[model samples]
Target: MKHVYGTTALLVATVALTGCGDSDAGPMPGMNHSSSSTPTSAAAAYNDADVRFATQMIPHHQQAVQMASMAGYQATTPEVKKLATAIKAAQDPEIKLMSGWLTGWGKPVPTPSHGGHGGHEEMPGMMTEEEMSDLGKQQGSMFDRMWIQLMIKHHQGAVAMAKTEQANGKDPASIALAQKVQAAQTAEIATMQRLVGQLPVS
Candidate 1:
């Protein structure tokens, strides 16, 4: 019985020691590091595709902001103004966000095809010199109807650009921005459709 108990005790000790590695063998020192590789996050692995997407989107969003401001300043309908305000608010921050990404990525900040970022000076879809005069020349239903029609087209262009980015962009941040644009513009499209229904028919 005494011999059997000693054998059993030895076996238990052996099993316990084998279950865990030696305590004295601490993790390797100095230059040695985790054998496990660090995973790159979506924000960390940006490439050229992401750069171009952000660049193109900056100008595209700027154009939308321009159109929205027109509705804000000129449209008589409260609904039109509200929609315009939403668009302007949405696009303005996006412009800054894209600009920051370009800066962070060491890419060129996007410039519009027309020129520098000046106030509503001549942003695309912003009424032209003659167009502005024409908008001013009209009032009430004419202005409201024209504003909604023009903004709907402007938002449509944004949707097109966002779709392109979704399919082609590589960076996580860039893709995220593109997805956001798609979702927001899609919703805005529906709003514009509803507003169009309210406009005075020419």
Candidate 2:
């Protein structure tokens, strides 16, 4: 009876140890499963083209925002001021959205050049430093005309970039954003053209 009791005690101890081991092991797999799947799923959804689109478009939109900001104080025409407000409102969020994409993709987010163009002047529809400076100096109807013209050119550049992304981008979200940019900027360009005709020559 003594030997039998000792054997039963040993068996119970072994089962308890095994149960403890399983309980400790259980959470590790779940932790790893969650951590690994999230990044993989996000990374898999984008490709290099999507990264490029996000990277380039961030600064591009920043410049547009800068241009729009100038209208707040300098523009005399109500229509130009309204359009500028709209441009800033639309592009500011887009800049943030693309920046978020770059962060998620493990890509570097482009910093805004502030008053400068971040050396992207060669890009479609980007204004040179001189042009932007000149626009800044103007007020009244001259500012209105110049702002409309430059904004039209800027929108054209954005549309061109969006088109490139639409053609080559792999991520559905990026492509959808590209389509949105294309449609919105194209419409803005038409509106600017009409405004330019109505405004007197600066």
Per-model TM-score versus the true fold:
0.66, 0.76
Writing each residue's lDDT as its tens digit, candidate 2 over 1-202 gives 9999999999999999999999998976665454333322145557787887777778778888888899988998888889889989998988877777677777888886443656575468887889988999888899899888888988898899899889988876687788999999999999999888998775
lDDT of 1 by residue, 1-202 (tens): 9999999999999988876555434433211222111112234457777776666667767766766777777778898889889888988887887777777666778666543444333223343456545765667878888776766666666677667777876765566767887788779878878987977775
Top lDDT hit? 2
RMSD from true fold, candidate 2: 7.7
TM-score, prediction 2: 0.76
Model 2 stretches with alpha carbons more than 4 Å out: 1-41, 114-122
Please identify model 1 stretches exceeding 4 Å from their true place: 1-44, 111-138
Error of 1 at 45 (Å): 2.1
